[model samples]
Target: MFKNLKNDLPASIVVFFVALPLCLGISVASGAEPITGLIAGIVGGIIVGAASGSKIGVSGPAAGLAVIVATAIGNLGYENFLVAVVLAGVFQIILGVFKAGIIGYYFPSSVIKGMLTGIGIVIILKEIPYFFGIDKNPEGDFAFLQVDGENTLTELLKVINALISGNFDYGATIIAVIAMAILLLWGNVLSKKGKFFQLVQGPLVAVVIGIVYYFLTKDSGLELSKDHLVSVPIPDGLSGLKDLLTFPDFSALTNPKIYITAFTIGLVASLETLLCVEATDKLDPNKNVTPTNRELFAQGSGNIVSGLIGGLPVTQVIVRSSANIQSGGKSKASAVIHGFFLLISIVTIPTVLNLIPLSVLAAILFIVGYKLAKPSTFKAMYDSGWMQFVPFITTIVGIVFIDLLWGIGLGLAVGIFIVLYKSFGNSHFLHKEGENVDDGKIKMTLAEEVTFFNKASILKELDQLPENSFLELDVRKTRYLDNDIIEILEDFAFKARERNIDIKLISERGIIENPDSFIEFFKLKKPTE
Candidate 1:
């Protein structure tokens, strides 16, 4: 791991920058302390990464779980919810031990596409408030499309109006803009040519700029509220650790509602982690496959640690994972190292971290979101296949129009429908084998399992069977023949007796005792043969 430090350090720094905003944003979105996100990121990197068997997977506070966490807090109270998170982790570990990791594989590719696209769209929408300095609760909190007199677009319009009409604080706005500018400059402009800029990230730069700007603009008597910037309580001295550990009252665990919250968190967090891990693996340059079982275990441990420490539940996150990969991470070491970095930095330099401007973080996420929702992404999905394109678009629309899980669920449903439609449709094989028009042989083999979809084609082929000539109806490979097709074969078999047609079925799983039902299955009203 040390040997890869040269590569890992740069990747770690990039991941740290990428994770900073998401950690804070997702936590805020979950109605938890912004520090909870940071704490999750730290544990994800340090503990989860170390324990994880996945080579390149990075874990953190997941946006996918933001809604679940938020609702849990609202329903069960924050204190009780913390206990649920710990329990969720325990559940995940049990799942991993059972080798349930392969469940991630069952999620359709289309659904996965939809998930990534949805997340991309959601990131952009949620960050809009931050980009303009409207200063909402947090970016991830936009799960339900907060009830305005109108809708999301209208509320967003109001936020825009506030920004334009000077209803928003200019001090925060100016500093945020400066932070964004600095970060962008360093990322897109300066980092290419310099070592220091590469060593330090644009978000950190924006944060530093925010601090400098804050001090420089303090005398302006701006209406900037503390809520606009980073807001973790900075306790004094080593004694501060006491406040970090938040204990949940487990006495109420017997409540059905608490159990419901625990199950919800466990399931949602697991799904998110699985999805993000898959996406991140795809995004990884090396294309390394992470061990899903160990990923679950790591997440479970991280959540357990986080719950005990007043932090948020954790999951593998694509945003930070992609950043880790693009920044050139070599192994899990970079991820583990970043965890320590987060822990040490927050503890030793809380005042410094608090200086990070929201706008600058927005700028950072703005880049991440762009990479995700890029125009090319749509083109790529469209090029993949109809199944891929459908769910991919649905996911994007769902997240943009409703919520993350809703979009993914809709996409998942569509994807599953496509799969089942194909499976049921492929139950049998269609053949056009009669004395050929050109060479005396035309066989259009149908699938093993035929359905109504193949009926038209099969009927067409059977109609063209040479009259009183050499006709071979081969059903050797077919397993389960649809009733409609079975009837067609039955009629054909009876009609072939009137001609010189020969029927043959070559299937191991096909009907042996009831081979006669092969034709009766279709039961054509008028046997043309």
Candidate 2:
């Protein structure tokens, strides 16, 4: 790890810049203290990073869980919510021990792509209000309907209305525009000029510029207020830091609601973590595969520690992980270093951090959102075919209109429906050369493996066979046949004789003459000479 410090150090700095605002934003969105988000980030970096099998994936408080955390906190109280977080961590550890990580593999590729795209759209929509200096809703809130009795579409209209009525904050708009320009220039031009520019990072520069602009315009009409900047609890000393931490109420263990909340958090956090692992692995240039079970164990440990220290639940987050990858992170050291940065910055420069404008962070998130939901992604999915395109689009629509889990469920449903449709239609092959069924020979070739899904198609084909027709039932290529199909064939043999139809049965074992039952014939295999 030390050998790769040349690359990891710079990557860690970039990831730190990207994660700082997000940690604060997600905490506010989750209805937790900003300090809680910072604590989670620190634990995720130092503890989880040390324990995780992933080389590049970063863990923290995720925006996807903001709604769940907020609702759980409201229902369970903050102390009880911490209890739930601890229990959720225990649950994740159990899942890891049971080797349940394979469940991530069952999700279709199309659905995963759809999920990434959906999240990107949500990020763009949620950040637009912040970009315009409207702070009615918390940063990182991505639900279609908001806690403030407004929806995504209405929020956009509110921004537009503010602009038309001159209710917008020019300070925020100017800072945001400047921040975006700097980020674009650094990424496209300046960063390419030298390692120093890359090490410093565009987002860090944007943040510093935002702070400078805040002080420069303090007495002007374009001054940004405290509400428009990052807010970290400034503690005076070790005693003040001690007061910032909150412990879980062990008394809540008996409450059924606590258990319910714990289950919800565990399920959602595990899913989001698994998805991030998949996405990050794809982003890794070396194509390294992270151990999913180990990741779960690491995340569970981090959440336990975080909750004990008054932090929000932690999960592997794609946003930070992607930043780490894009910034040239070579190992888990980068993640660990970023965590230390979060820790040191909050403790050492809380005053300076509080000066950075929220508009600048919004601009940074806008770039992240665009990269995730690029238009080219949609075209590529469409080019893959309707099977991929349908689920991909459905997931995006569901996420934009509904919620993340609901969107993934809808995409999975569509993917499963497509599979069933294909299975129902392509179960077998029927060939008949002549038009007259009475004279022509009918050949029914069974698929490689016939299941109950093919039962309907098989029955229909059998019923349409002409009386006195010569039918050949072929199962030479079949490896396994469902019991229902075997019964169907057995029952058909008796009925075929009644219709004066001559039927020949073919299989790898050999031909059967007037078999009484397909099951009996298969069970009575001849011994080798």
Candidate 3:
């Protein structure tokens, strides 16, 4: 654990910076106290991160949960929401017990890649507000658009209005710009040198600068600006702690809606986690495989704790987890350590956290978004194969135009369509190369069950057989043939009479089903030849 701790601590700090804004944003978007996001992050990091089997996956409250969380809070009240979270955790654990984690593995490579790139595109679109000092919600959109607006473009306009009217705070903008500058410098310049500078990460730098910026603002007696800063609730020592606790309503468990809600959240969160894990692995220079089942179990544990503590349910979120791996996280320990940092920061210095600028975090996420949906990513996908390129590109567009799940579903459906079309059209269903004559005879083998789709190739093969040559149609292995093929055979037999062609059926049992004409044309029952 110590060895693991060594590697995870640095990675954890990077993850912590990435995670902090997200925690606040998701909670605010969910209509819950921003502190709830921190609670979820703490549970996700400490319980899920520590218990998780994935070596590098970092857990936290997911933006994907914002819709459900918001809806649940509105419909069931916040206390009842806790019950759903616990129930969702239980379902996730059940999924883990049955080894349903493999479901993630079954998704096509194209679909998974598509899902990640799509999420990246959505992140980029949604974060435009924060980047420009526009504060709607950091990055939460379900069907499309935000609660206060429609589309990223509309939100940007709102931000412009906020900025021009002297409504937007300038202090955070200044700090955010500096944080971004430091972030850029850290990744591009400072990281190259194997010196004291390399030891410090950019997000950490942004965080430190944010603290100083806050101090400067506070000392100057500037007006409070939630827009310019991280706005998560910070309890004042013991009293704030008391206000945060909540008890679940057991009666809510009796609501069937709770179960449906639980399943939807559990299933979606798990899928998002798996998608992030796959994308993160690809981003890894080492190219390691993640244990998906263990990840589900870990997420389940986190959700359970999160629910108990009045936090939103958690998952292996890619935005932060990817940052961890990119920052050179050596193991899951990094993820676990980050959880501790979140807990300590909230418990000891949440007031300071509120001081950190949202713009700084936006800059960090912008970097992440760029990495995910880089122009090069599209080029690389195009180069890889159509099986990958189509779904990946479509997923990005779909996700951007719609939401996370819809985009993934659309891309996956297209991918499956391609797979099935290829499966049934030619490769496995028909034997083409074998149709050429062998010593004046052609043999065509029928699959165990021949459907109407087999008619084209079968008829084409029959037509190609030499006018005077013998053709052996084997149905011994076949159990069923569609009527379309039977009709084609019946028509061909009539043609054979004029062409002096010899057609033979080789089967242990006589033909039981065919066109009525075909049945009458071959009147001899069971000609045992």
lDDT of 2 by residue, 452-519 (tens): 44544576678788887887777776655544456567667767778777877888878765667776
Q: Choose 2 or 3, whichever is better by TM-score.
A: 2
TM per prediction: 0.75, 0.79, 0.76
Please give the CA lDDT of all the candidate structures. 0.70, 0.82, 0.72
Q: In candidate 3, where is summed lDDT lowest over 10 consecutive residues?
A: 520-529
Model 2, CA-based lDDT = 0.82
Q: Which ten residues in a row have the lowest lDDT in candidate 2?
A: 520-529
Writing each residue's lDDT as its tens digit, candidate 1 over 468-501 gives 4544445555554544355446655656666556
Model 3 agreement with the true structure over 177-224: per-residue lDDT tens digits: 787789889899888886456557888887787777776677564432
On TM-score, the leading prediction is: 2
Model 3 TM-score, 2 decimals:
0.76
The 10 consecutive residues of candidate 1 with the worst lDDT sum are: 520-529
Q: Clashes in candidate 1: how many?
A: 24
Ranking by lDDT: 2, 3, 1
How well does candidate 1 match the true structure in TM-score terms? 0.75
lDDT of 1 at 256: 80
